[model samples]
Target: MQSAIPVSSVWRRPVSPLHCRCEEGDLDLVVIGAGYQGLSTALHAARAGLSVQVIEAGGIGDGASGVNGGQVIPGLKQDPETLLALFGDEAGRRLIEFSAGTADFVFDLIAREGLDVEHTRSGWIQAAHTETAMQAAVQRNRQWRAQGADVALLNPAEIALLTGAEGYRGGFLDRRAGVVNPLALVHELARIATEAGAALLLNDAATSLQREGTFWQVSTRSGRSFRARKVLVATNAYSEGLVPNLARSLVWLHSFQIATEPLPPDFDFILPSGQAVSDSRRIVLYYRRSADGRLVFGGRAPMRVPQSTDDWLHLERAMRRLFPMLGSMRIEQRWFGRVAMTPDYMPHLHEPQPGLLMAAGCQGRGIGLMVALGGVLARYLAEGSREALPLPISPLVPIPLHRFRRLGVAAHLAWYRLLDGLER
Candidate 1:
């Protein structure tokens, strides 16, 4: 469906020039998917003097990158202690450091590129919905603090004052987190990438890929093709059969969002810290204040696949549970996007085939992670070693009975919803 908002309203810059044509013959790199990862990779590679060409199935940021809730949160989905237990201390520390740097890298890029996207570094809070969760938040704060993260464990009074809600028992606040206008950021990045000499081809889907001696031949449905020495698949959830190996390795789940009309000025008293807040639940609720004074909230909803519907009554009810004062607020916009989730919740960068790299499975945190992944992929493409990646790159392995992922996700969501109800 066409958006009611004008394109220029959300995107500040002009379309990238590379979205037009594909050059003849071979290129240094061909990137699939024009989301944040793809755009960032192209920008960094081209700026480093490589001939880069990016192909997108749809318009720039039309995928999850543009449709996300725009929370620029830090760290990976997996807990650091769990990572250390699984991969040992050294690898776990490396993983934590890499994920944390994602937010820093994003802010640095915004400043260096001088993009007009509304970025705010007001920090983020993880609110506890139950006593058990509150204890966990305290432990998490301690862990993060030991790792040099500027995190604090807030008391119930502080939580109530910060969130403007009495529902949360307590929580942890991290100053390293923030928010952004994701779509605008992607558009600006695409423009900057083109300015740096990278070619971006929107509406050009990479239909197939095959190895041609040392190079990879990537062909699009529009009869356009790119013979590149290196190809990076940054498609995320919209990978859509581009690489069978990589596709099978990840499961797709839909995350839905609804934004309220510009918040009343008095709402500031509720969020005195002016930070983004998310509840600690399996079916988590993440919400933040937009630069325009709107409350944008989102969470996982039961859906068979990626589809948008205006029937967001369930999500609105969920929002009201957090902020009863917003019960009368009108939902100005409703949207949904698919996220690629791995079995272990950790993102993977894989060399599914020789000379072809696949980076996906950011779960629902791709905004910050994708930029970091781009830097990792660029280094790998230039150096010819996955070892250069800050995070580990393991072989792609699909979840057992992967074809039934939707059923599994639906059942999980149902259980989580029940838990949320019980807690309430």
Candidate 2:
């Protein structure tokens, strides 16, 4: 009735990564990292006729951008009421409004750029694994709908009808949520940026950064140096020793995904509407149909960095449990990526020094949120005013005893898993 196949593999991107030859020149902005955020910044900056250059350690979308679940869900990691309570009324409202439209912003960008990424706006289902969890989904629908979000509470039957899965109790559907090929999306943005005169260099990592008078000098591992008036560090979960105390400020967690071979054409009832779906649990479970009819499913990774497909046995078991119809469907691929989680489970914009801007700690909700934040950061840089930003800029605060983050995360996962089991 179930399988434990561990065929670790990488998703072959539609296009090869760009390898632009760097030139010796200064730029208006230097974006470090070619993920969604950095490339998005480059796109907006290049569109405004600014000299932009993006430096990436590996190929474009080599990091989490290539391996993410690709669910274009809206809002921050925290709920609306929680954000409202933490940030107060006016600022909270602004943050809610901005975050709610992140998916819309992404789809809009795709249509505007005529990018051929396999994107769909068939809505997103947040399924509840338990009746108790369904109550929370009800609250979420109320909170989001009050902010003008097109969300509705779904009964258990509705959940089953929408997802083709019977185990879920109930949940909510956000009309704006969707999915896309993250690799394709990032590559398209990179193409747009380069065509708009922005320089993008892959296989290049910013080794060191220093400020001199009014400009910042960035040295790459390939021995090339570039100077820029403004520096934007968008290297989220992959920020390993890139900047002082940057990596230490966030807890890095591993998220893994597994894909099944294309379901038989006759099995059309499974996610028939083609909407992306995720369950409401501390360790989130998400799945969607690929353009080729495969089921791209994902969930939490092991406490440690996952090495092989076998390391994602939990996800395999979860998938089989939810959809028993796949009695022996072969798992075609397995991959994992790191997610930068802030203590508060929210994104942070840091301006630790003048002319330097760093944004990170997405807490596993990056797809749409990353692009939205990138646009906001680009505008803030051009306007040279923090007042123009939807979220306030804050100083970097490194977590105390950050060396034990891995152990702490292990404990956190254990507790969350325990709670999830009890609730279920």
The number of the candidate with the highest lDDT is 2
Q: List the residue pairs that clash in candidate 2.
A: none
TM-score of 1: 0.94
* Candidate 1 lDDT by residue in tens digits, 1-424: 2433322222233343434556667799999988989988888888778899889888877788887877777887766787788788887778888887788889888898788788888788889989999999977887888888878998889888887876888998988888888888888888888888888788878999999898999998989878999899988787777787677788887777787888888788667667888888878888877677777788886555433444456778888987898768888777777788888888887887787887888866788899867887787787777566776767877778878877887888888889888998
lDDT of 1 at 254: 72
lDDT of 1 at 296: 79
Query: Tens-digit lDDT track for model 2 on 1-424?
Result: 0124433433446564454756457778999999999988888888777788899999876788877878898997777999889999989888988899899999999998898688889999889988778898988999888888889998988888888876788888999899888878888888887877788888878999999889999998988889999999999888877688889888887778888999998778899988999888888888998888888888776656655556877888888888889889998887777788888888888888888998887765698999887787888877787765778788788899898877877888889988877776
Cα deviation at 125, candidate 2, in Å, is 1.2
Q: Cα lDDT of all candidates, in order?
A: 0.80, 0.83
Displacement of the residue 28 alpha carbon in candidate 1, Å: 1.3
The C-alpha RMSD in Å for every predicted model, in order, reads 2.7, 3.1
List TM-score per model, in order.
0.94, 0.95
In order of listing, the candidates' clash counts read 1, 0
C-alpha-based local distance difference test score of model 2: 0.83
Candidate 1 stretches greater than 4 Å from native: 1-19, 305-310
Candidate 1 pairs with clashing backbones: 18-200
